[model samples]
Target: MAKNKDVRVTVILECTSCVRNGVNKESTGISRYISQKNRHNTSSRLELKKFCPYCYKHTVHGEIKK
Candidate 1:
């Protein structure tokens, strides 16, 4: 079986703008992305520039706690 402390793990990225604006009333949902990262390589939280459908522009997406 695979070890519990694998080098790569799954994480979720959420748009910062949408969350800060509280704009999830009528929209489908907040923009989120599923991605994998190497735990050993990067110990800090991951953040990337991604497209936000709700905001209709590129925004900073930060790693969220599982």
Candidate 2:
């Protein structure tokens, strides 16, 4: 028997505000999150609202290349 393929893939989400700002004013790093998405359900890039410690506010986090 062959192993089944995984339907869920891991994706990296990055803070949009931090990228646009070039650098975080309060911190020296960008906010990032790890999540899983269904390949069959969503083919497009994933975007979510999450809290950023560097930004100190909730912002849009978009999926990025690994």
RMSD list, candidates in order: 2.0, 1.7
Prediction 2 global C-alpha lDDT:
0.94
**What are the per-residue Cα lDDT tens digits for candidate 1 across 1-66?**
875888899999999988898876667779999999999888999999999988888999999999
Q: What TM-score fits each model? A: 0.86, 0.89
Candidate 1 clash pair list: none
What does candidate 2's lDDT look like per residue over 1-66, in tens digits? 889778899999999999999966669899999999999999999999999999899999999999
Instruction: Please report, in order, the local distance difference test score of every candidate based on alpha carbons.
Output: 0.91, 0.94
